[model samples]
Target: MTEAATRRVPGAPCWVSLIVHGLSATQDFYSQLFGWEFRPGPEQLGPYVRALLHGKEVAGIGQLPPDRHLPIAWTTYFATKDADVTAEAIRSCGGTVAVGPIVAGSAGRMALASDPGGAVFGVWQAAEHLGTALAGTPGTPVWNELVTRETASVAKFYQAVFGFETEAVVSADFDYQTLHLRGRPVAALHGVGHGLPRDRGPHWMTYFQVADTDEAAARVTGLGGRVLHAPRDTPSGRLATVADPEGAVFTVVRPPED
Candidate 1:
């Protein structure tokens, strides 16, 4: 397990959350898959629960209103020193702040925004909740990345909004860039061009760490989730892309053993 964060870092991926229609079923699927336990969270927005691993907060799952038609997907939230400032920066940088920099009780101030490419994300000014409490272990988020049609304009947007320094992959065939803050890589951007999913559009993808990628992929299938990509070895580790039964897509990875 990763060390608990004592403070939030501006522009870093601080949390990930999912909104689904069937909260109980979704919780059960994740509980069996990742050994998570759920606890009630602030209900200022809706029925929500914080997922915990060994009593440490790992992620969040919330229920959508019956009349709401928003897509069921995992949203990545970036930490900010000030949500209002971040929201204004997003707007001035050609991104759209679709939701408020409003307070969720005393948990935090939050706003939902989309980059120029229409990839949705959240900016959070934390208060009582300090975002994800544990990571880098099974059932916890390991990475957050934006898979979009192109990286240039969106990368500029992020940099202008969050002051991220970027490092591009020196490759002829690949279009990838890593966004960094304070000399540490925080998140990544990939240009998939026309290969972007028609149904999903441009969106952030969350990666959850697992002990075994192949086994996790199989478990996803057994739990009624779909494996969008079969487990494959990469320089980073073995990984698979998958979607929950509700169609929220994420990746599962097992890093190379030390």
Candidate 2:
């Protein structure tokens, strides 16, 4: 098996960061929900801003150049050893490379690409920075999911690119499959079915841990963000779908940790 196939995150569910169109507004929306703290990064780093939750570094947020019309949303990044090879794997698997195997100084390298199902994800080659030094508390990434109406096609798409295996996980109440890399659970994939809204697209949504679901949902609307779905309970936790001011849909989950 390929090294990439065998490679597993020693601790899965790593930190997730995103590049948004409107940095100021996105910052305000998230800070209120998670009580995030932010400050300017190195002066040479341009406009990149680092965010901390509960006094621990959680994610990075930066503004897209003025010429780009990208929507504001969270992008998921997986830890990889070689970002360039991963980009090639993305192409080889019927996925597209959307960005670069760009270097992040002594912090390792990264690249952005989309899966065959149109879900965008990132690959991080960690050096000094291993990603989300802190996670799963108030203000860090709690869970990541890929939601699609055609789960089989999406599964094949990810399996072809990431070299991970997936099995159908069906139960009396829930229908989902867990994605495994070398038999280790990396993430989950499930069908959204035709009951989903029309504007919804096959995509990966990152969830942030929070204290209260209703308060978080209300704060999203209070800050110019939209609540795509109201608070709902799953076997895992209480979750609510939301969109940043620029229209990227993500979820906020407050699950009891083990």
Candidate 3:
């Protein structure tokens, strides 16, 4: 099983989505790398669509709408017991509250917030279900990692909101400080004392696992997705950056053999 699969809260990371600028091409590019199939569903909010990977409901991807002016990015949803409380903790912990504390039908509730370093994530309150009906296999969401500065402060922020415990990132000795909730690793923390990509703001990036990073990267190229960064090895294993034909950027991670 994937390290991410071992991190479930009986239904954690239940859902996630990649916010993009263009819907048509974004769908085509990701279908190649992750083998995801997105189809229009009952319109709930905006152009929301159901995302499936390997024939299982995994997540969602849709245009953020032009009025929002938000860049294309991936957002993850962590199953929470209470989104209202989670939203409050986010503000108290020096994070930004972007949206929610709103109930999403019977599926559950959600609150959108950002960490101290400006990486945005969501808190999900599971009702009849918890999170992703599927995860942690090849071409599925195996991890949600954050790359930013202020590892300690970021850890503190998440701890306050999600009740996660964190050790010193420096001690993890890995590229990022891993965080745990309910005795299971939920996400990672990356410090950025170094310079940014030509100087951009700090943000969160999601990594979906695949069987072969090189082959997936090649598929991304073939599907007209932009390769932002070539495959590289980290303490976590091989990873690469890719942007959909529509310019939505996300990563692909291939963990070391178990």
Best by lDDT: 1
Tell me the RMSD of model 1 versus the true structure: 0.8
Candidate 1 segments exceeding 4 Å error:
none
Candidate 3: global Cα-lDDT? 0.71
Q: Give the top-scoring candidate (TM-score).
A: 1
- Give lDDT tens digits, candidate 2, residues 1-258: 001212226324454766777788788877877778897643333477878765556788887778877655687887776778778888987889887888776767778788787777788777766777665466677678887766777788777666768888767545578888767777888677775556656667888777888788888888888898999998888999988777877788888555
How far out, in Å, is residue 126 in model 2?
A: 0.7
Clashing pairs in 2: none
**Taking the tens digit of each residue's C-alpha lDDT, what string does model 3 give over 1-258?**
322232246224556777677777677766666777876643544676767765666777766767787766678887766777777878888988888887666666777888777777777787754556666687677777677765766776776777677755555444457787677776777776664453345666778888888888888889887788999998788999887776667788899876
Clashing pairs in 1: none
TM-score of each: 0.98, 0.86, 0.87
lDDT of each: 0.93, 0.73, 0.71
Q: Could you give me the TM-score of model 2 versus the true structure? A: 0.86
lDDT for model 2, please.
0.73
Model 3 residue runs over 4 Å out of place are 1-12, 169-175
Error of 2 at 243 (Å): 1.7
